[model samples]
Target: MLRPRKFKELETKLGHRFKDPGLLERALTHASVRGGKIARFDNERLEFIGDRVLGLAIAEILNQQYPEASEGELARRYNRLVRGEACAKVARNIGLGAHLILSESEADSGGRDKTTILADAAEALLGAVFIDVGFEKARAVVRKLWQEQSEPVPEVAVDAKSALQEWAQGQGLALPKYTVVSRKGPDHAPRFTAEVIIAGRAPAQGEGASKRIAEQAAATALLTREGEGGRLGDA
Candidate 1:
């Protein structure tokens, strides 16, 4: 069946055509919208299914891509890949934000560009794709979208701080700078707050007993923010 010109354009970007056009529309519709044959929840259920759907797809992709990597290594990469930031990055790449249907308040508040909304909408789109076809097609869409992020781990698996430094250097940036923001609490237990700064980005802060721990925590926060799973790996 023929669809509106906009959906056809989106399908071209998704690299898949939907057998039921309504599924594609539902995937793009946000929960905030209510009325006229559209419920406030259609996309949410799709988002739920998409979350699991994405996990399985990413796991399979990792399994095939990193045969030599340890389970821990693969898990870290999986966490990074399945994280909201990563999904939001993909949504942004496809210009998915522009296609979203949102309530006036939500749209005015920049729901389209908001990371959480974009991530959920992205997964919902995957769910729509899964339903329209099957797991094989869903995996194909994921592989096509996540190709670059699925590359081999760049730095040797190490502590969060070391990993963050290597990540920054890999991106051709200066080493991360750690600063002590405050020291509080009693002599029996002193609390330290440290902030780590990567050039051109805002600082991420973490708190711990000692300056070293605080620095490491800060590094982990930054790496997590950058969606590398911080490489902490059960630390």
Candidate 2:
């Protein structure tokens, strides 16, 4: 059967023709679009399964690709690859934003471009594919999409927060302070917004599912700005 125009385009981008396009459609449907209560119809259930599917696929790849790496190293690399930012980046690369089905309010509020939503949708897609096909095909898709980031594992994968602290200490600056700017979403999946303030530097803001992730994002943002130029940091 011919698919809808949007799903056709999405399938092309994903490089996987779906036998059941309904799976893809449901995966792209956000909770906000479905009144936040359609447990069986929304993407949240798919997202939950997809998270596991993604984790397993990544683990298999990491194990095979870097046989010499230790468990700790593999764990770090896996964390980086499976993080919300990583998923969001893949979603953007595949132009998944344009295919999302969000409520009018969500669309008006820029839900299509939100990191969390995009990431969740990406995971849901993976889950849908896993269910539609088999593990091997899902593995192939993961391998293709995540190839760029599948380089050899580093000896030490210092998190952004740790790296930022080390940089600050190296510059003889006081330790950066992180404040929770806002918290939203359901209890199961709360979104936290954090702002990090460095002495003599302007604050940078980031959002994530937890306080730790938000702080790390904020620190990473600050570090990225500093690396780009002296102005963004100063501002």
Candidate 3:
């Protein structure tokens, strides 16, 4: 049983106490910790739902704050905000890594500080909040953690894959092709390397927790290799 004070700091940070503390417990429980359980007690299910919750919340924010922006423009900002990287960043900001409930082996292997674990746990936490209360309450927590959208419009958050595709079209070149070169590490926490090949450009590669993120990374790598202006690259 978790001590009543165990989650005090996290609860304070979230600005809401859990009505059913098991939700928070489940959120923090990593898959590595579940020892062959028949029931799904880990955070994975919560992470799944939490991903949707976070996306919905951020989409709502973008809709209201960027009402004048085009769909593409909104998508860029939305992608940037809802990414695993952003979620990990938020987890770190809230000191969420320290609270992960990992198995002895996982903890010894530094799973607590891992980017994927932290990001998934962050989403699970949000999902737990949603289940505990409702969307309005969960959205409020997201808004607080993500902060008010009062800053000037950010320009650097463009979706790299989209930009790469657009660049290829603009240049009258074949579309960029992404291939998963390697997927390594444990199933619970996998690492993927993906390569991007454009018809006239030298292939570039990047790695991430998932194939989609790896593809994005590969696109970003190709873009960076080209030029600051995303110019043509050497074959």
Best by lDDT: 1
Taking all chains together, the TM-score of candidate 3 against the true structure is 0.73
Q: Model 3: residues >4 Å from true position, as ranges? A: 1-3, 148-150, 157-159, 162-194, 197-235
Please list the C-alpha lDDT of all candidates, in the order they appear: 0.86, 0.85, 0.84
The candidate that wins on TM-score is 3
TM-score of 2: 0.69
Instruction: Tell me each candidate's TM-score.
Output: 0.68, 0.69, 0.73
Better structure of 1 and 3 per lDDT: 1
lDDT accuracy of residue 19 in candidate 3: 89
> With candidate 1 superimposed using the best TM-score fit, by how many Å does residue 209's alpha carbon deviate from the native?
18
lDDT of 2: 0.85
> Model 1 scores what on Cα lDDT?
0.86
Q: Which lDDT value does model 1 have at 96?
A: 92
Residue 73, model 1: lDDT of 66
Worst 10 residues of 2 by lDDT: 226-235
By summed lDDT, the worst window of 10 consecutive residues in model 1 runs over 33-42
Runs with alpha carbons beyond 4 Å of true place in candidate 2: 153-157, 160-235
Clashing pairs in 1: none
